[model samples]
Target chain A: MTEIPTTRRLDGHSALITGAGVGMGRSHALALAEAGAAIVVQDIVAETAEETAGLVRERGAKAHVMVCDISDVAAVNAGVEAARADLGPIDILVNNAGISGGMAKFDDIDEAYFDRVVAIHLKGTFFAAKAVLPDMRAKGWGRIVNVSSIDGMVGCPSSAHYCAAKAGVLGLAKAWAKEFAPWGITVNAVAPGYIDTPMMDGLLDDAGKAAHVAARIPLGRMGVAADLTAAIAFLVSEEAGFITGQTISPNGGEVIVGF
Target chain B: MTENSTNQPANSRFDGQVALITGSGKGMGRSHAETLAARGARIVVQDVDRAAAEETADSLRAAGGDPILAIADVSDVGAFAEAIRAVEAAAGRIDILVNNAGIAGGSPAMEEIDEANYDRMFDVHVKGAFFATKAVLPGMKARGGGKIVNIASVAAMGAVGSRAHYCAAKGAVLAMTKSWALEFAPWKINVNCVSPGWVMTPMVHAVTTAEWRKTHIDAEIPLGRYAEPWEVSALVAFLCSAEADFITGQTVSPNGGQVIVGI
Candidate 1:
């Protein structure tokens, strides 16, 4: 009934995806590469990042592996520099690297635990955007997609840390969008809802997942990587020039939000 | 629309889908038609202006799409509903419905606006989008799945000054889009809204001068320019595509950093 267009929307561009080892980040890398973008796959896990890079290369697009914890500002800057040297300047930045802590209510949550979650999700996003802005500014064109979540929009019970970090990224995208639009750069967030990714597997078992979907998600299923990736592809394409500072929630009707 | 457009199909995303776009007589609606037709949707051009609608049909035919015409103003609920059913009968089924039928509310301050003008604004944008979706839902549900994109404006998101009716109408459309997404999800219908920022449409040209363009676009708008119709159309077409199957209850604004906060 439908066919995904084979048009390469990102030809001659280089994209940097954080947390590209597995799940949503890996999916975004593959989809962008499929759209003709040369990918810089960055993740703390060197092996998985390389695995994603290999996948990108197999698609006949260039790929470079950069291994670094995105939370480390110095390391992220170095990785961006090395990635630029190996491939090209980052024309697109998907601030996708994130960490979700196991459920700990506010009383049980330790300072270290909260800091780590915020460090990885919010701090990591901020510094990564900082690292890639100069190149995009000079070029006068770029795309930045921050991967937020349903928890970000609507608060998640017992997952306040994750929610705060995720929501922080949304604010970051808005501020960056306003700041960078003059340079022809767009910054936006894609807040996904209950996606069937590795992250969910870590949080919920099969039964929990099914019950949640049946109770909450109207689509009657968990979202897939393709759903998020397709949105990222649209946000990064040339046709999306007029769009910035927006959060496109591909949640299968889970959360109907409006201005 | 050009081949460089995002909706320019390399393999036809909507190869067999039938898309019914209201207000296809001119502006962004026509571009939406072109974008979808390029991807192989059988278009049903619905517009009150017969002359302009015919022009759009001719272009669609030239672009290799066999389009149907439903010459009815969307605000005419009974007549437009009948026209929609005619489209369903003619085209076998309705797969996509773009509630793009709208008129520009003139720049009259809230007090200066008359009751008739206010009613006209809501009648076209709000009532039109609402009933049109109501008309199309059964066919879409029967067909297993469907995509509905309501065309909103950036004016709905902020105080754009004057034309409170237009803003209110678009704001209602945004709210209605949310309700529809929730209400229609059981039927596998994905309802969404596209709030474009300062597109260079007739609605804009009717109000602005060179000075308005130079100052307003450059000063207030971040991208320092307005959007081309295809730019907004490509986004609408994306929402209608299978790739966007999981996206519902969402409002995508391609407004070049104008009025970013939509919370």
Candidate 2:
């Protein structure tokens, strides 16, 4: 039998995870809740976020579900405040909601497609971080784990827009790492490869594309949500105070770039 | 030994794979070899020190596994060539490569870091891992698939007091992994890297005094303890397995709640 720690890693701390309806955002919410944090599950899909909140409640944790499109600034601010009013200060923020849209070669990318990707991922992350920054600064302790992608670090064939936005997340993390370090607000990101999730399923449904993408990774397999969860869990934990402005990749040995 | 055996599953994910681990004379490399061997992979124990490499090979033999010994300085060009040729002769195929051989030079400040230290660090980590991958890639392409895992450090993610060149070199390795992954993807070759935090290796223990370590490494990681080599080895083995097929162009961070860089 394995030993269990007496204290929950995030006990008494409240966490706000954007895109908490599905995919990585959902995983982060549940993982943080398991670690003893009250959760604010915010998503564009009201019912989906509520479903996630229901799961959290079943786990005997306090959860407030909010329906708000993270891409909208005013909505994000109000949602954050509602969460703070209900659960106390938001000590941890997980910016995991993102959209890959349709994959296309760089030359094929249209302005609308590119703009949407940026607005949801890049802009969404900025506004969410803005909303939580003051509260975290007041408390003098905060953790931000952004969800990026391996494509962000190294460019991809049809994922130029997605890659650029994710790369933006990294830049944002670095700048904030410096900006928030003084306030003890550590920010980092987790870049996953082709993780097996609803998002991946949709992308990989085309057999030709799936085959082409799968052959590129070194691990000879697709990533599971568990793989990413383990990495994020370590990052947002209190033990990760000194680990700011860093990008941790949990891809199966497919891209061997420097840390 | 004909076939090594341990508690890992048979028809194991690593079955039929030949894993070449650098610096297997001891520490993280040895742990990687032992674990991979247990998973039914043929092992290539490599190190700069001859006796140490052979000793590790002997240990694998005693453990009921087959391991070939290759003693050569990874920084030396001719030595790396010979090592690859030797593995081809022993194992008949190169299915996996783990670039774990490296040196952790002194704790001199960035300005005080001398040229000799910088060159040596890059030579072993950058040049060594580079050529080794270059030599093995052709064989992997011929075989239609393979895996490469480079051992990077959290230091590469940012400035960590000293070891500037080491950080830069590892960063290059990380970048190179991405390029190589894209280049070799058509051939079904996957290349990835592992960037660990302060793990309790002999080199680390030797370079860092107890007092210095207490204040630096121990105090930095959130877990408040150094990682065991086996912990990193588990991650390496998993990456080499079939389960990680879609994981290319990525770095796996196994630091104990430390090094929160972007994923």
Instruction: Please state the i-RMS of candidate 1.
Output: 5.3
Per-residue lDDT tens digits for candidate 1, residues A82-160, read: 9999888898999999877576688877899998899999999999989999999999999999999888998777878
Worst lDDT 10-window in candidate 2 chain A: A1-10
Clashing pairs in 1: A242-B254, A242-B256
On DockQ, the candidate that comes out on top is 1
lDDT per residue for candidate 2 within B1-263, as digits (tens), equals 22223322232348778899988888788888887876678898889998888888887787667888877888888878887897797789989999899877756678877888888888999999998888788899899988888888878875676767877888888888788777777677777787888778777787778989778754665444576666677667766766455556667666645566554
lDDT of 2: 0.77
Query: Which candidate's TM-score is highest?
Result: 1
Worst 10 residues of 2 chain B by lDDT: B2-11
Off by over 4 Å in 2: A1-8, A104-114, A157-160, A201-206, A253-259, B1-103, B107-263
Compared with the true structure, what per-residue lDDT tens digits does model 1 show for residues B10-116? 43278878999999978888888887887778999999999999999998898778999999989999999999888888889999999999887567898988999
Backbone clashes, candidate 2? 30
